[model samples]
Target: MSETWFITDEQAAQQALEAWREATVVSAFQAHQALDDTGYIEAVETVIADPATTEKTRRAWNMAQEFRRMSPTVLELAAALELTAAQVDELFEYALTIEA
Candidate 1:
């Protein structure tokens, strides 16, 4: 038997949102680097036209498109977590810093 650790629903939601934000930042950064190295539009067109593209590559390309359109925002997290306006504002401020 192993010990089980439990957290409040709010705590769990906050943790999940934080993890998602971190992942978004890292993914966006890597995607930006790749696009910058290869030429953004050209790289995306190449990736989409290539039949041999791996799932991971496709995912990165999709993320690049989304990031280019609008970097992921804390409003998304807030909606997913059902957070209050004040909490969302706080998270939004922190999220803005993640990419920088």
Candidate 2:
């Protein structure tokens, strides 16, 4: 179970998004430290197996879901969740957004 707290800290959310985005660069070896030997191979296999994922998250996930990867974004998730990307990004749009 998760603790429920009603808080509207927009700045905090923005900061969180920044962290997630940075993670994106590191995972792809475009920036930051690279993954260890085993993990790197595993990741490459995952991506090649399914090179489809939300553009934002494709880096961390092995591959995008077959059908879902077609259009990866909060908009797509929103479609599944019945919401808009813009409406979702502020809440979930960070570098980690791709991971989720």
Candidate 3:
């Protein structure tokens, strides 16, 4: 037997994007230093392509991508994690600004 959410690629894309947007707004911690810029973004896109990326996990990944910058290093994470652009985007969301 098998199970599925029946979610389309477009829907997954939207959810993955939203996940990152939401994450950035809420996650206040400095990103995992190990994670390069675009690290989260690549992760989410990979999720969108993967069969295992559940809605719940995709949402979590989005939260992770938010507030992060876009950089070339995304490629490194992509290669290492075997992720896609959308999956990386899924890792994060919006972010609140801080006053210095």
Question: Best by lDDT, which number?
Answer: 1
Q: Give the whole-model CA lDDT for all candidates, comma-separated.
A: 0.48, 0.37, 0.47
Off by over 4 Å in 1: 1-30, 33-40, 63-100
> lDDT tens string, model 3, 25-94?
3232434322334355445366445766455544445455533334333334455477666555544322
Off by over 4 Å in 3: 1-29, 33-69, 94-100
Q: Indicate whether candidate 2 or candidate 3 has the larger lDDT.
A: 3
lDDT of 1: 0.48
- Choose the strongest candidate by TM-score: 3
RMSD in Å for all candidates: 13.1, 12.9, 14.5
Query: Candidate 1's residue-wise lDDT over 1-100, tens digit each?
Result: 9999989999999987666545543345544454445344364456555676555545555554334222333233234345576554443344345553
Superposed Cα deviation of residue 19, candidate 1 (Å): 21
Q: State in Å the error of residue 60, model 3.
A: 24
TM-score of candidate 3 against the unseen true structure:
0.28
Off by over 4 Å in 2: 1-7, 14-33, 37-40, 46-100
How should the candidates be ordered by TM-score, best one leading?
3, 1, 2
Stronger candidate by TM-score (1 vs 2):
1
